[model samples]
Target: MREVAFIKQNKEKWLEFEQAIFGNLKKNPDDLASLYIHLVNDLSYAQTYYPKSKTVVYLNHLASQTYQKIYKTKREDTNKLIYFFKTEVPLLVYQYRRYVLYAFLIFGILTAIGVISARNDDTFVRLILGDSYVNMSLENIKDGNPVAVYKSGSNWGSFVGITFNNLRVGALSYFFGIFLGFGTFYILIINCIKIGTFQYLFYKENVFWESVRGIWIHGSMEIFAMVIEAAAGFALGASILFPNTFSRLNSFKIGFKNTFKIFLSTMPFTLMAGFLEGFITRYSIDMPHFLSVFIILSTLSAISYYYLIYPFKVHKKINLKNT
Candidate 1:
């Protein structure tokens, strides 16, 4: 048959094949096996009837790829896990570094602005933190404790509560990417400003180093996760703005998948941050200086190694392999 004649004769079958491949067909194991058989038959028909047509060419390619995947499912499963860690995770970490740098730069500038404003005005902390919170902190500081707020709840309760809250925030930060990433940016800016203002308050009280050592014991992990969340948001946003070779819908689907992976990756860090904040921050003043420094340094080191060093190492290995 001629290409046009073949397409017209088998158009319904082609539609069914397309639906099976990309539509919501709800395939059980038996149904999946039947669908694969149908796909193979359709490809055979297209090859026989319209060998030179684009439809035939595409169907041939699709059938070949699908057959390989279906036949090697068990083998691919193991390789896919290895591929995710060695390739996908490292690339994600690398993308997050750019977002981290952006967040840091913005926060640093805001911090400088906060410090300048605080130095020039006596009530800047009260303005930034609200009068009530400042009063409470001042009272706590007067009692020789600056971070007593975290110690109010039972440790286990605090851990569960704080972990749940952080997870919610991280999930929201990711889900908002469905709105094209504006929500993530909004959250990031608000958090960054709060940190800047909060730190300036400590600086104003001449307790900057003490506050840094206290807060950053957990803040390093918490803040890095936030930046990673923002990077996921960027991926979602960029998928919409620049679909590249893929259709907009396809790009968005891929972007959402990547972003979801990144969101999942932040869970452990979120829990660790919660633990430090709820349990460790309360005793910062009592903890040995070396221990506090060590926690902070260790947290930073882990961030550097995971996001920067490890990713570069993986990329270098991949490049060497390709060469």
Candidate 2:
């Protein structure tokens, strides 16, 4: 069907939905849910046939509002926290998967820049990482304990400090989305550059594997969570930049609520990373290669599955049920 005809056919129903949604018309919970299902069907159709049209964007916005309304109307007697992780966060992640891709792509580019700059400019590493840290790392390398920095603090102290610091970084990466995401991008760039340079330093000292075994024991989850937090920030910014059918303020409110949930989802992974860093990373030098590799790969795999693979599964399940 032509876009105009499609809109002509459904516009009245949509307007009625708008009335029902905003409380201009009375709607029972089941009635609103049925209407929401119809709206979703329309949304799916628009996505398929008029993907680039304003009609599609409008339908998406309407569908989101309806979904929220349905949830509000029918409060399930379930654990809110468990439902958040199991259903809500996964759906949000799937909805904003593109932003996550963009964040990772940006991270890759910035990291490459760091690697190339560190390789070409002799002073670049020290400039980015600081001279004192560089000197200390070099001495540690000489002492054949290349990642000995992990051993500096007691386990509990390091765990608390590292967790707090990581949480702080994640929060900044999220809240900085208020600046149209540039602030979040800056945060990501700084961290990825430092990471690239730090890794390159290890490669330079012929202890690349040593660095990986020590750092990635926790770095796997830590770094991945940071990228995801950045993705949430991007979503928040996009909400402001393109409000679709919503007022800019309303768009921002929805975006902040959804994206903030996504940010919160990363907390457990970050905490686990901190635990591994404080307790296990300090023993990396004497740890067996296979064990270290397993820990690193396991943490990376767990996080990767949650953010990348599991969201699709949940999305599919929901779609199937709705269909």
Candidate 3:
């Protein structure tokens, strides 16, 4: 379409947006998000087809202001944070549910590979888990305390260190999506393989049940958070690789914005895992079998409901909202 025609088409909508911005704000945030998405689409087309025209410049400025209004700006209050997790995040999780499934699928497949490889070769575990780790586990097994490794560090130190490290790994996985998501996949593969081989080693030592009761007291949340991080990364990479109707930059903007929230969603779970591993896992074997099972199942159920089931409910409610 001609530049004049384009300007004529969107000029009134832009004027309305200008009015909304300068006047009292009344639109629902979700409604504003829809407007921002359409505005971005228009801005992207203008940049592509009429880069030298005033229309392009005008749209660019308008889009920038709208983005600031919709995403970057918010009323200052505690409810803002609550609304973020309670509403904004769950909806995005529902929107990108496929990426979460893809991440889980990749982790599952590679985990199977790790188990198969380790079972087929004695050296495979050592190769993947490193000689030191394998030897330490063997020594621990010989000492009749196969899960003593969690006892190495002070509980508080371990709590702080583990939480920081988990967040770092999660953040790295999310950021690596900048490399077209391949980097994130590599991290996910490495992590899944580590879990597989390590567990298989416990199995080989005839401590499979004991290992499960000890490890999964914390591993449920820890491993699940890592998988969610991989989902965030994959979501980012998918956005870049398949911008669909939006321009590459605009798609990326949406991807990063939403996935960053998804990444944030993993934080409380990561901290919970860290706390359990530090304060609880060291004594897991000493606890009653029923208690161990209870803890593990409870953690799994919480994560499953939050990341999987709850998002659907939140999405449904948001759709039914009058706005």
TM-score attained by model 3: 0.79
Which pairs of residues collide in model 3? Answer: none
Candidate 2 residue-wise lDDT at 225:
99
Total clashing pairs in model 1: 0
lDDT of 1: 0.69
All predictions: root-mean-square deviation over Cα? Answer: 9.2, 2.0, 7.4
lDDT of 2 by residue, 228-293 (tens): 999999999998998876689878887898899999999999999999999999999999999999
Winning candidate number (lDDT): 2
**Per-prediction TM-score:** 0.71, 0.93, 0.79
lDDT (tens digit, per residue) of candidate 3 on 26-138: 77767787887788788878989998977775665455446546753554554877877876777778778888999999999999888998999999999998999989989
Per-residue lDDT value at 72 in model 2? 60
lDDT tens readout by residue for model 1, 199-282: 777766777787887889888888777777766776677667766434789668756766677677777788899898888887
Two-way lDDT contest, 1 vs 3, winner: 3
